[model samples]
Target chain A: MDHQEIIPNLFRTEYRKIVSVLSKRFGFEQIEIAEDIASETFLTAAQTWGLGRIPENPTAWLYHVAKNKAKNHLQRNALFEGKIAPEIKSATSDLYDGDIDLSPENINDSQLQMMFAICHPSISQEAQIGLSLRILCGFGIEEIAAAFLSNKETINKRLFRAKEKLREERIEIAFPEPAKIEERLSTVLTTIYLLFNEGYYSVSQNKTLRKDLCLEAMRLCVMLVENKSTGTPQANALLSLMCFHSSRFEAREDKNGELVLYDEQDTNLWNADLISKGGYFLNCAARGDQLSRYHLEAAIAYWHTQKADAKEKWENILQLYNRLLQIEYSPIAALNRTYALSRANGKEEAIVEAEKLKLEDHHFYFALLGELYTDIDNQKAAQFFERAISMARTQGDKQTLQRKIDKFRPADIPD
Target chain B: MDQYLLLMRLDIITKEAQPSPEQLQVYMKQYHEWVAGIAAENKFVSGTALSTEGRVLQSDKVPIDGPFAEIKESIAGFITIRAESFDDAAKIGADCPILNGEGNSVEVRKITSVNENG
Candidate 1:
């Protein structure tokens, strides 16, 4: 591969590993120093690689350079002498050796440890995601900003504050104790879910979809599932939910980058592989007695993926949605349950339930009303469509609503 | 061929002035590109990028402890290249990556060789 492709791929995979190893060795307070050494290693590679061919083994070359840089840093800085020297002196008597021990197993342990460190409860959810994107996923500040639909300055400040919090809290790069594991893991799973949704739902300036963020979230989730301590039933359920949602990714948007309603979506585009994997994870999640919201949501997503659009499918979805709403009464889930109510019951009953929701400000509330009224009352449907269009924030949603409005003629309206 | 020394002078590097490590990697790539351009033209010579710390001395005085001094900008590092004229050497120095902003500059001067054989 060309340098353009090779360098970024390396950065994405190797950058975090180096940071993990260094942070693990130097302690959490010295993460910036670790990052500096990793950055310098890449910079030195850039400086020399231009004059000569890239080294035969680039990773090894980076490790060697970073090792030497860390050694030099330890020797030069008095700060390291005070903080790190004591730890090293205690761990190993050979203080001057400066090996920094980045073995394969150590590197894996460090990265997994960092995953927990970034999810410290002391950090705000926003800051946790910012740090995860930067330190764990190897995302740049610009990329993180784009993912969050914010500006660079905001993202930079968020990351700066997050790193400061990491230092202030003195969070170690290690797994939580057994008693705290479940709670910490929940925070991590929620962050991953939010990350995936950001990609799946957000509209990009240049592109209609931001699949990169979704893929990164899945990649991190896979890491969680692979590890013994982190692979909880809730995590498996989250992964299953993600897989089911991703299976329908191809049908979410049309060629013109317009949002496609579920009824209009081509079922042929759904990925069978992901659907089967989601099924497997959902089964795995069923092994436990405790029912998390993820289990309910994954069940809901699974019902949506079924090939048959019969009343049975809708009934199953409606039940799962009901259970989910009971567990977590989010307006979005209630709004969705209203749609399922229309499918399982009828539009008339669904209309009564949807109206009682009193979610007047939500565009989807109006959109759902518009959809429920389509065959029943064309005039009311047009009115609801108009309201939905005005309430919509994104161009894609507005276009979809406008298209629905276009189906109704003025003559069909009643004063 | 005349040997010329290009001395790079810049203000003390501060955390505010320095790009974060993530950004520095990108700048390093650009630096590599610029260096490669000069290397392709066969005008490149050996250069060393200096670390931040060193001792300083005054006439009839002992060496000082740090790089901080009275000067607004200190000589950061230097490179020697073969050029026929001062203008040619200056032109070569113009492409140096560290000549980045207002306070940073490259001063090119011809170096006198004291080789008796020559």
Candidate 2:
């Protein structure tokens, strides 16, 4: 590849590894210093590579440069005498003897450690996601801003505050204790899940940016799953859930680029490869007796892949939804279970259950009711649809509800 | 051939002034291209980046820390190139990546010999 593609690819892929390893070595207290060294390494590479002569092994070349820069920083700033301990004074001397130990093992270990570090409970969830995008994914502030539909100053403030928290907490870049691994991993996964959803259900209309967020989530998830220390069954299940959702990403929009509900999506547009891969991960997640929320969500997402509209599929989905609500209740999940109840039993049963939810404020509740009453009572459906359209938050949501209302006239409605 | 020294200066080296690393990586490609352009014309010589910390002495003043004395800007680095005239050298300096903005600039000076070969 030419420099354009190659340089950015390296920036995204290598920047994280270098910064992560450096941070792990220097400790979180010196994270900014590590970041500076990492950034300078790339900048120096730019000047050298701009001469149109790429180092034979660019990654190794980067490691060497970063190592030298780190050493120079240590000596130049006297990091040991003032603040940093002799831990680095000794760890860094190895660079002089040999290499900086950018081994695959060390890099992965550092990155996985960083995944937990960025998800510290001290920061807000949004800030955690933003920090993850910056430090772990090597996303620039500008790109993170575009992804969040936010401006640079806001994102900068968020990141600056979050990094300050990491320092204040003295959060170590390492895995949690075995006893608390599940709890910590859950937080990390929650941030990853939110990051994925932000990309999946975003309103920015920047398709590439949205898709990139999902991809970054997947990359982070894969990192967690591959590492033996943190790769719990729940991690696999979360990865499986992401894979299933990403497989249908392309089909979410129609020929005119309008949103396509899952029921109306073309099966051919779905990626069979990802669907099977999702299944593979789901099976991997089945190992061990643990049944986290991710397992339930993965099962739900897995059933979603059976696009043939079979009664058996809906019944299984309904059962999973019931269990999911029992474990941890969410209004959205409850609303979704109502739809599954409709498919599994009948519209009348679903309408009764949905009405009992009394989620009068949420537009999805009205939309579901509108869908259930379409054939039996077009007038009722129209009223529900009208409420849904009015209550919808975005122009896109209003148009979608309008389309749903338009789909069922006095005839041609679902049973 | 006359040798010209082009001193690179910038008001700021980082934070708001520096582009994102990704942007800088791509932006630095222009410097490579400029160097290639001059090298092809046989005018390129050498370039060196200055360390931020050094001792700077002014007339009848206590020596000051190198870069921070001038709060307005830093003399980042310099490059020497062979040119036919001051105009040619200045023209070459015009393409240096360091001169891209308001306070950022390049100062060009022709090297004068004390003696023929001293």
Candidate 3:
């Protein structure tokens, strides 16, 4: 009962099971109620369990308390109706009649169903990710709002609208049919991938990387892999890609937190455990005949992870980027492939590819172009750097570009 | 146990000021989809759509054709649904198509019941 004394891991395991069970029992439409009751149950447990030894079955205790809270809510509603109050009493007493199993299998299936329902394509992509983090990952609204780079009010409106749409559409709590699984899975994977991307390169300058978001994404990936129904080769590939990328976090930035280019990062700082795990998942991804975009991206990460030096892996990285581009062509991919080309060939080839992209409007693109030009001793590139500084959105990015411009300034200008 | 009124305030002037029939048709389609979707999900309660024609009853019991005030402040339609709490009602209101137009908004407020004891 004294949950304060309980270990964090134990509490989380028990809490997740209880929450998943209650969420399923109350229906997805009653998610807020379920979450409220779960929160209250944990609060009660914290007070009661801390006074004594932890319960032998902490999960069951939490579930029972939550069920009672839900019954109390129903009774309160019944009282408002002024009907037979005794009927509410009977309902409350019958809360424990059914033996609801909270096994790992049941919880995983229910959570997976909830994830698919929340991530339905009918909802906007922003709403899908926001709802998933809130309902499935148990994130607070403020936290989700921060992750979205918006104010809490805007996020509240978006979430309210998303839930309303879901209720209005009567979106079923079920997985996509076998034939449509791959397509639906793509949306789900994309949400998880973007979730991790936000964690890796946070939009907020104050917090470069939010470990909470990264861990939540990894936890969700692990859940996907656990459930046989939802697990697929692409899911494995995405998990592998996340692992590979996360492994380099220790070496991603210097002690002062400035961005360290891959060529300058110390290879010894990479986590070997994560690299092996990523390689294993990548192998699992390769089992399927079809190759997904995640597969190609993971291959690229794997090449970087396994190489002794960035210079040795340039050609492999370029090939992977080429394959990735063929799967899904985007401005970001083209930009990245240009960087790889710079490493493989020279600044000239990189400039050609970079110029082909009509991304003058993008600050980072121009800044990178300026860097490539600087590599080739072109003073005209200083103008591009100046333009990039003007277009830069963040103070940090602007400062970095300004420094680059000053470093490559013409001889005629005073230092 | 909180009761809420989902007020759908429509800017009739904006709708009437539409430049083309195609725009009106598109707006109509959106409303139709919304009603159908809500009805299918059983979220629809009692509601009514008002005609564009406006009538004002003066103090002298004279009825005049008028919406003398700003057209932006008019209420076109509304529906009331039973919900467990204010949050539930707000969630239901989020999907209302009344707020979809160029300059329209849906306002959700809890309805307070009163007694004559005071």
lDDT of 3 by residue, B3-95 (tens): 567778765655554437787687778777876775676656567767666888879978887453455656777776656777777877877
Lowest lDDT 10-residue stretch of candidate 2 chain A: A90-99
Q: Taking the tens digit of each residue's C-alpha lDDT, what string does model 2 give over A2-64? A: 555677889998999999988988899888888899899889988888878887888888988
The local lDDT score (0 to 100) that residue B62 gets in candidate 1 is: 91
Better of 1 and 3 by TM-score: 1
In candidate 2, position A307 carries an lDDT of: 77
Give the winner by lDDT: 2 or 3. Answer: 2
Residues A1-415 of candidate 1 have per-residue lDDT tens digits of: 6555667778888888899988988899989889888888878877777667887888898888888787766666645556565555444334535458778888887888898899878988888878888888888788888878899999988888888988998899988999999988988998888888888887674343377777788888888887888888889999999999999888977887777888888999999999999999888888656788899999999998988889999999999888888777888999999999999999999999998999998999999999999989989998888888888999888988888877788675544
For each candidate in turn, the TM-score is 0.73, 0.73, 0.69
User: Model 3: per-residue lDDT, tens digit, A1-415?
Assistant: 2355464544445555556666676666776676777778878887887777777877677767776777676556556876755644556446543535466677777778777788888898889888877777777677777887888999889988998898888776677798987778778888888888888888664343366787778888888876786678889989999999989887876776666666668989998999999999998877656788888889888988865655768888898888788768878788888988998998888888888887877887887788788856546578778788889886667766776766753672223
DockQ score for candidate 3: 0.01
| lDDT for position B30 in model 3 | 79
TM-score of 2: 0.73
What candidate 3 keeps of the native contacts, as a fraction, is 0.00
For candidate 2, the TM-score of chain A alone relative to the native chain A: 0.92
